[model samples]
Each structure stands twice: as structure tokens, then as C-alpha cells.
Target chain A: MKFSTEDLIEGIRSGNKRLIAKAITLVESKKAEHRQQAEELLKEIMPFTGKSIRVGVTGVPGAGKSTFIENFGRLAIANGKKVAVLAIDPSSAINKGSILGDKTRMEELAREENAFIRPSPSSGFLGGVANTTFETMMICEAAGYDYILIETVGVGQSEVLVADITDIFLFLKIIGGGDELQGIKRGIMEMVDIIFINKVEESNLQKAKTTKLELKRALDFIPAKEKGWKVPVLLGSALYNEGLSDVYSTIDEFISLKKKTGSFEGVRVQQAEKRFEYWVQEYILSMMKKNNSVEEAYIQHKKNASAMVFNPSTEAKLFVEKFLSKGPD
Target chain B: MKFSTEDLIEGIRSGNKRLIAKAITLVESKKAEHRQQAEELLKEIMPFTGKSIRVGVTGVPGAGKSTFIENFGRLAIANGKKVAVLAIDPSSAINKGSILGDKTRMEELAREENAFIRPSPSSGFLGGVANTTFETMMICEAAGYDYILIETVGVGQSEVLVADITDIFLFLKIIGGGDELQGIKRGIMEMVDIIFINKVEESNLQKAKTTKLELKRALDFIPAKEKGWKVPVLLGSALYNEGLSDVYSTIDEFISLKKKTGSFEGVRVQQAEKRFEYWVQEYILSMMKKNNSVEEAYIQHKKNASAMVFNPSTEAKLFVEKFLSKGPD
Candidate 1:
């Protein structure tokens, strides 16, 4: 069970499941030593990592996000594609509720030999660019999974982050709007390239149809955020086992279209740039957090602010300038 | 007026229009010396800010965004408030077209002695949270402008950046959602606290009404992103001067509710924290951008990436770590 960077790189290329999972654990580990090893593993496997179709799936708690993903994965498997599932569990930091989102929920996909599901990192930052999640994705892609499905309970910063690393961001809704849509973030609506109105069964069929039209009306107004791709709204009942193919094909159409328009590579570059920017941010903040003077300056400036002697912008600028004055030689 | 920092600060406090414009120019100056003086001027007038009802307005071009803001500003002034308009002309950098958004567009408001209008900084870095905008807002507040109207084209980073500095974020949309909403960013939709469906006069009234209903349906599904308030969709015609009062009152209600819930100050603290974060980010990026070694590392790493020798996560970590290794004396 010992996994080194080469073992990981080889196992992933040859499709070794246990070794792939081990590689993921190393990547998700918080220990500095483990992170070093994980980085090495990822680099060794870099050649194999960009071959898969990476799709990010997100929705609210009861939006049939899990069911739709389950059926979608199974459909992909049936179509001769090996599928790997990864979930970004934001709530794990609070309630450990993400325990319920694992293999138990995607039972069929979990039981399939061609499908591999790794639970969300128990120690992730929950944002879309979780250091470990991004690394884990590289591992999955290198393991020769034909499709990488990243699921997140669309809340907090997940959707925007998901869009950054995902090829096509898919938001699944359970055929209803009313109060259910109340909790949905509009940013999620904007980032999605495809919308699936799931759970359109016997009684909800008409409602789902109407919801589709309404979505189309609103979405039709939204010029394309992504290049050369019209955001499409489709219907499905994951429970009834229907409409999954159309969903799959539409996703296929999106990738091919974006690829043809050069947006596929263009988006990947943008994602890389965003990730680079994020790292610089996190590193600088951490460095300043370690400096006592920055803290003192903030306290002094905030005191001055509360007393009406310093404005917020001035206070912020002063604090930053103080840090820069002491910044690296 | 030949402006000194102290004179500019006093002029702003005493409501001198020329002095206030001078203070804004100093804040917007990229030169280190000017930035220092701007900070001093801002600190001098810090006590006078945080009193006005700061409203951030955004809408796509041709969506009556300018006309809507002009009416909104005038309505506030007519209600016994001194209105100051600071437009975040994002397109100014590219098209140099923000000239039309100045006093010439809002003739009545522009001519009113009580109104102070600053054309969007012709040299502003397109995104709305330009540091100068923050300082300009403070100067306007100190100058006794009871209402601060910040207008931005809804298509860029301006709306979200404006949201960080303003109390209530308003998105102005004309009747139908189709092509008009096309250019609108999804983040703008999510960030807005109130949406005004403008141009609801004569023939466009019905379409506006239906758009309102459709918006309500989607908004109702979205739980309030902020506490103690519901995102309200209002009807308005800035051209006809109808429904402007409702929009104003709804904004008033939002501020009052947020105040009662203590989220008003809570949001301010969050804004301050985000600004601090952004400043640190900009400082680090700038420092690295100036370093030949970092640039060389990036090019080499990127080359390795294109050759499949480094995954993005690995590449980013290596670059950040290189910077961190060289950070702090």
C-alpha cells in the first residue's frame, strides 16, 4: 500500500484504483511533508491529467443534485466511459453532514467497477479552488478517468470557484422555482453553461415544462458569458431514469463548441491565472498575519477610524503600506 | 483652486465643489506622493463619512442606466437630500465614452447648486473598486452630500466592487430580460439588493410587469443573501419620473432593516476586511511583477506546464513558495 510519486504516476496511468485514492489522500493531507509528496506526485502525473472531460455539478440541498449526478455517472459508464466523482463538501467544516454525500448516495455508481468516488476532502477550505480539491482532480484525471464530476452543494463560494476549474459548470434544479429558488445565488445562475431541471415526473411534468420556458426567457436575455455557447435549459427525471442522454449530448456539444471557438483552452488559461492570483493572495495574507506590526497598524488605524480620524480607505492604505515597508528584501 | 491637502480637506468639509473635485483627483493619482497626500486628506475628513445612504447603481449600456441614476439622484435631492454623483466609468479606459455620463447628461441635477457631479475618472482602472472611488465617496460625504449615487456599467467587475463600498446595490433593468440581460454579469444579479425594472411607461409597461413577475419568481427562490431583508423588485420609469419614489423608499427600508439587524455595520466591517485583503493582494502581485526572477520562474513554469511537466496546482504552489522564500527580511 506504499505510494511514492512514481507509483502514483504509474498507477494512475495504468488505472490502479487503490493507488489513485492513496494519491488523493496525499494531496489532501495538511502535513507539509505530505503536501510536498503530493506536489511531486501531481507533477509526475501531469502528462496524463488533462485528457478527461471535467464537469462541475452544483445545486441547493434538495435540488436533486445527488440523484442527477448518480444517474449521470451511470449513464456515462454505460456509454463506455470511466467516471470519477469528487465532491467539495463545504459544510464538513461545521457539521460533518457531507458524510451523507459519499458513496452511499451514489450507490449505483459506487458499485460499478468503472466508477470511482472519493468523498470530499474532510480538511478542505470549501472554496472552489481548495488546494487539495484541485490537486485531487489532477490525480483523478491522471488515473485515466474519462469523466471527472465535481459536485458541490452550491452555496458560499463554491459555484464561482467550480466554474474556474470546471470545463462545463452544470447546475441541477428539481423542477421548481418558487421558494426553492429563493435560496439560490444568482452568481450560480450566471456561471452555469447548462441548466438541468431535474425530477420532472408525472405530476411535476407540466410545471417543469413551464419552468423551462421561464428560464429560457430570462437566460435568453443573458448574452453568452462563455464564448460561442448558448446557455441551454433542459429537463430530466433522474428518479424515472429519463432525459439523461440529451443532457450528456448537450454537454458534449458545449465542449466541442468551446473547443472549436478556442474558448476551451482560453478558459483553462483563465482558470490557471485565477488560481495563480489566489495563491499570491493567500500567501501574502498569511505572511502579514505573522507580522505583529501589521496587526498593530490595523488596530491603531481602526481605532483612529472608530474615532473619526481615519477613513476606511485611508486606514486600509496605511495598513498595507506599513506591511509593504516591511515586506521581503 | 490651487489645492493643498489641508485646503482640500477644509473645502470638502465646507462644501466647496472645486475643492472636493481636487481632493478626488489627488486620491485617484497613482503617484506615491499624491497617494500619501490623499491618505492624509481622507484621514482629516474621516469623521464626516458613514452618514449618507450610499447607493451603488449598475445596468448595461442602452438600459437607461444613466437616465435612471440621474432621476434617482434628483429624487433624493428633491426629498431634501444633497446628492453627489461619482460614476465608475469602466468603459472610459477603452472607449473614452464616459464623457457623456457627466454633468451634461443630468442637466437638471448637474445645474442644481446642491448637486455635485464628478465624471467617472477618465483614467480609472476599469473595475469599480478603484481606490479613488472609495476616497471620493468619503470626500462627498464630508462635503455634506446626503445621498451618494455611484453609477457603473453592470457588465464588468464594477458592480461587485461597488457593492463592497456602497450600502445598497441597485441594478437597473429595462422591461424585457432577453438581450439586455445578455451583457449583464451573473455576479451583479446575485449582489444586487434591489432591482429596478426601468422604462415602465406607456407601451413597455406590460413587458416590464411580466419581467417583474419573472424576476419575483426567481428572487423568491433565492433566500436573502444578507440578513433581515428581502431583495425587492420595483417598477420604474426614470424617463417619466414615475416609480422613482418607490425605488428610493425600498432602498431606505433596506438600510433601516439592516441597521436594526446590525448587519449594516457588519457589512461595513466585511467590506473593510475585503479591502484589506485586496490591498495585500495588489501589493504582493505588484512586487512579484517587478521581480525579474519571479517573471522568469513563471515563464519557465508555464513552459513546463505546456509541456505537461507541471500541473497548475503544483505550478502555482511552486511560484508562491518561491516568493514566500524570498519574503520578509
Candidate 2:
């Protein structure tokens, strides 16, 4: 099947699954020919993008992400919104393969008429999510999905990067654990918009309530990193489908409040600015690699150091000057 | 007092404070001329580096990092080793200046003959450490400091980056403060080598012990990210200087074990490899910016999107290709 930019754009605008999947595959592919084609496809679909709300979900391995996402998706669908789920599986350190299969976990959601499910491999790159995940989110948005949910493999500092690329950051945690909240790393909590205590069912109800109070108290000591908004802690159970209505309502209220205060646009603008800076940083690094100036300087400096000859500082400056004087390629 | 690379190198080797400060100032300078000089100075000192043990300490404000480091440094010096404290102060969001003055906080250490103290401004950088901190470490190492302690503003995930650049990561926390452990981010704990329950003096000693045992149990389930090492939880009091000796002994044991097993060299090699990669990345990114490829592509892409003409993916690909083909500057 031949895929073009217009076809993908039209299919997405019309909510065609096959085209959307094909477009994402093209964007995710590493092959040179497919990459160029993907580029062309994105150009055609660019106008239809940025119309959706992008929510990023992250937590530890047993944090009930799939169940919560399913509940959230159902709520959105019930509200007449088309939803797309992009589950980023944790990558293998050795070969960079994704472990969890989102299709299996989100079976019901995958089967929904108004939903699209994408199980993406993290690619084991820095910042947790795949480098292409950001592009994939845009593709989903362009395809007429009004709600894009990005589910990350809850591992390390990558979730923070995931937060940077999303509209709302949702952190999931289980109740009544001996986990060191003080050790939770101040950075992640500061970035969170909402902390949802999951699995508040049956025996865990009291524990969840207790944990919620504890968290509220703890948050008081930590100064709010974000302006205007306070991080809210809520409880929900993905298993029994309890508190999901409240969750949805809270999200709606938060969105409306942010939009009214112009913070919605402000957040998006900040994200875009960061995206721009990251791209520039990535580009410059690529240039240095291609030029071999780094290699030349490294080799010479290593030799000088090993021999205890001229100091490394002098050698580094000389290399930088020589490289700069060579001008643009 | 004109400073040249040779003079700086010689003075640093001879333990001249002025030369050492001048070298760090050069590295920290953003001006083009001073930057060139700094780079040159680094090349000279690169050979004399890598002998020091780099330790990264991080905890929230009121976690007693300065007090802890002072005691730790004094212990290191008492053991006949020179210590250099590179303290990174928390940056003010409004003025972008660091507030915590290390000289005032670590007055005792500052007065020690065998200790070198330098407080670096975070400058709103993500890592919570200064941009030239790694370079500064090298200069300090060359100046005969065998133990280099990097103290970061315990801001969560960014603190992990500080750990990434160090040999050992020590995370500090207070004891028995209403679910203190539950408040810590799991991500930070995963990267920690040692978890010190600080302020464990007369009043909190029992609580600290309980916290340590609880933490040990918690660590069991969390799964260590690094192979062959369990994150050890210890009780300490920076105020009373209790447990300082044990902390130093634990670090020494770890380093010795690593050395005997050949992991010490292996770790350093890996760290050096990462540093090299970062250097290359920065170089290429700068080159891309110089050629205006990013700015042009971004502007063109934005313009096309507004006109309903171009897709973001396609624009990104074209932009990347054009920039890549343009080659290095």
C-alpha cells in the first residue's frame, strides 16, 4: 500500500485507523527512504495537529497504569471525545526491546471503536521515552484524536521528560507502602500536576485515605515549583472503577481553570520553547560528531597528557580556535 | 596578573590558591576569550586528573548537606587526604542567582588547610550543578585533591545527573517525621549508593535506627538498578558528627572492593566515555546553531503550519536532512 501525506492527513481527519497506524509506523521507522516519506506525510498533517489534550501517565512497574488508563479512556469516550493511547514499554538495556505489550494490557480499550492504541518501544534512549514519541503524539493529534494519552514505563528520570512533552502530568502510586516519600526525589513531585493514589479498593481503602492525608501533609513542607497551581492528591481504584468520575471531573475543572487563567496556553508555549532548545542542542552535537574536530582534539589531548608534555588546557583552546576558524561546512 | 595556561598549570600543581581560583573562573566564564583560555587550561590539566574519588551528596533543604560535608571533609583530611568541596547553591527563579553561600555554611572546612571550598551557582541549569562543574572537578583533582565532593541542591531527578557524574551517590534525609520515607521519590533512591538518615542525634537516634531498618526492607523490594551493589541505609547525625567515621569507612570499603575486583577502573572508563559523549554532543549542537539550520527550519515549519501547507513531521525530516547534509562547520 502506497501512503502519501494527503492520504494520511485525510484518513486521520476522517478517523481512519489503518492510515493512522501507517503514519505512526512511518514516523517510527529508521530506514532512510521511509524517513523522508514520513517527513512529507507530517507536512500534510501539520495543520490538523495541536487540537488535542496530551496527558502523560507514569509510575512504577506495578502502579496499575493500564487499568487507570482504561478507566480514563472510557471516561473520555463517554464524554464524546475520541481517545488515543500511546503506551511506551520499558526498553531492554542490552538490545533496546520493549518488554510490556500494551495490546494485551489494554485489550478492551484496543477494541473500542473510538480509540487507537500504540505500544511503542522506548528505544532505551535518554529521558525515558523514545526520541520519536514526541513526533508520534503530534501524529495522533493530527489524526483527529482530541485526547492523547501517553503512558510511559515508570522508570528513572525519563518520566520528567515525558512530563515536559505533555499537557498534564499524572503520577500513579499505590497506597500503604513503606516507600520513602522523602526519598521520592524532589524533582519529579514538583513536576507533577496530580498524584493519583491507585488501587483504592477493598482492603486498601483505609490505607489509601491514610496515605492521601500523609501526602497532603508532606506536600506542605515542599515549596510549590509551579506558579499558581498546587499539586493535588486524589484517590481512585482502577479495578472496581471507583472514583473515576471524580477523576474526570477534576481533570475537566483543572483544564477549564487553567484555560481561564491563560495557564493552558502558557504551559504549551513553555513546552514548545523547551522543544526548540532541545532540538538546537541535539543539532549542534550532531554537527561536532560529523566534523571530527572532537576526535582530533581528543586524540591530541590524550597524547599530550600521557606524555606529560604540554598541558591539556592549552591544547584544548588551540583545537577550539582551529575548528572555529575553519568556518561553517 | 596575566594568566596563561602554563602559569596556571604550574601554579595549580604547586597548590597556589590564586592560580586554582583563576583556573576555575576561566572555566566558569561564558565570554569567548575566557572560554578559549579555559579550554586550553583543561587540556593541560586533563593528564593530572582522574586520581580523585568523586562523591555526590544531595538532599532537600534543611537536610544538613553543608554540615555533613564539613564533618566528612574534616574526616577525610584527618585520614591524610586532601578534599575539595564543590557546593552548588540553589538558584533563585527570579534573579537566577544562587542563595546558599558555602563559605558561610562550611566556615570550619573553609579554614582547613587541606580542604578546598568552591560554591557554584546552579544558574537555573537542570543538573543543579554548574555547567563547568565537571571541568572544575578536573582542575581540583589536578591540584592534588584526592577526594572531590560535589554537593547538589537536592532537587530530585536533576540530582540523579549529579550522581551520574560521580563515583558514589549519597542521599540524605531526616528521621521519624510523619511518614518521611513515603515522601521520597523512588527514582532517586534507585540511583543512590548510600541512604543516610541524617539528624540522628540524642532525640532521633532510635527513630533513625528504625528508619534505617525500614529502609533496608524497602530497598529489598525496590530492586537495585546497578548490578552487584545493594543501596546501604545508614544512621548519621551531621549536627553531632556521629556516624561520620562509619560513613567514610563504608565509602572506603566500597572503593577498595571495586578496586580489587577491577570495577573501579571499569567505572571510571565508563564515566570518561560518557563525558566524551557529552562533549561531542555539545560541539555538534553548537555547530548546528551556527549554521542557522534549526532557526530556518523552525521558522519555515511554523510559517507553513500556519498557512495549512506543511506537516511537522515532514518539516522535521527535511530540516534534519538539510542540516546533516550541510556537514560540520
Top candidate by lDDT: 1
Q: DockQ each candidate and list the results.
A: 0.40, 0.16
- Candidate 1's C-alpha runs over 4 A off are A1-3, A62-64, A97-108, A124-129, A175-185, A197-240, A286-310, A313-329, B1-4, B67-72, B99-103, B122-131, B174-189, B193-243, B289-309, B321-329
Docking quality category of candidate 2 according to DockQ thresholds = incorrect
| Residue B72, candidate 2: alpha-carbon lDDT | 91
Which candidate gets the maximum TM-score versus the true structure? 1
To one decimal place, how large is model 2's interface RMSD in Å?
7.8
- Per-residue lDDT tens digits for candidate 1, residues A1-329, read 26667877778878888888888888777555786787778767776777889899987777777788788999999999999888776556764555344446888778999999887677443222354566688888877789989988765676666677889998887755463344456566667889988878888888888887767766664547776777888888877678889999999999999889888887777676666556545445545556777757756765654444566556666666677777532
